[model samples]
Target: MAKLIFVNLPVADIAASTAFYEQIGATKNAMFSDATTSCMVFSDTIHFMLLSHERFRTFTSKAIVDARGMTEVLTCLSEDSRDEIDARIATAIAAGGREDTDAAQDYGFMYGRRLEDLDGHSIDLMWMDVEAAAKAMQPPAN
Candidate 1:
């Protein structure tokens, strides 16, 4: 069986977090969901376990970082195009998430936009065109 990745995030409200993720095109996995947690599936291999604060605490001894004041981790999602990255950020804003950074990055080969979820988790929607990157890496014609 293929290994699956489960990213467990602490949220104040399970339902609200689940709804936010739903708007961003994730679907709930009813097979592994309940009142205390919701399994938000972004893809076949990637699953986000949105757990209530109390439930999340059980898994870690460290205090939960207050994301509003400091970043805990930056979760990045790759897209097929730069427009797709922008659209995802826009959708996140429309869904009540806020832009954590002022502008999208254009590094010649890749582009990205950052946003903070309702619970302040930092997420980056990015597009890295490998062909473009490879071209950029090539030495200029003499």
Candidate 2:
């Protein structure tokens, strides 16, 4: 069976976060969604669980840090091309997210942008040419 990943995030507002994910092309899995929890499906194997502060607290004893002030997790998604990366960032910005243009990284074979969602969770959008990246990583012969 294929492995699947579900990222759980503590969100300030479930409705706003759900709309943000939906605007960026993720579909809501109604089977797992309710007033305090939303299942946002990015792909067949990738999913995000947006949980309210109270709901998230039930999963752990540690206090939930405010994502707006602290950097917790940096989630990244791969894009098909450099253009696609920029496009995705643009879409995210249009949906009330903000792109950290100063954090943009660009190499000849790779490009990436750091985007912050409404609740200040960071999401990185990246594109890379596998062949070029592999060549760049190879050590020179003696």
lDDT winner among the candidates?
2
lDDT of model number 1 = 0.88
Per-candidate local distance difference test: 0.88, 0.90
lDDT of 2 by residue, 2-37 (tens): 999999999999999999999988999999999999
By TM-score, the best candidate is 2
Candidate 2 C-alpha error for residue 90, in Å = 1.0
Itemize residue pairs with steric clashes in candidate 1.
Answer: none
The backbone clash count of each candidate, in order, is 0, 0
**CA displacement after TM-score superposition, residue 78 of candidate 1 (Å):** 0.7
Name model 2 segments beyond 4 Å from true. none
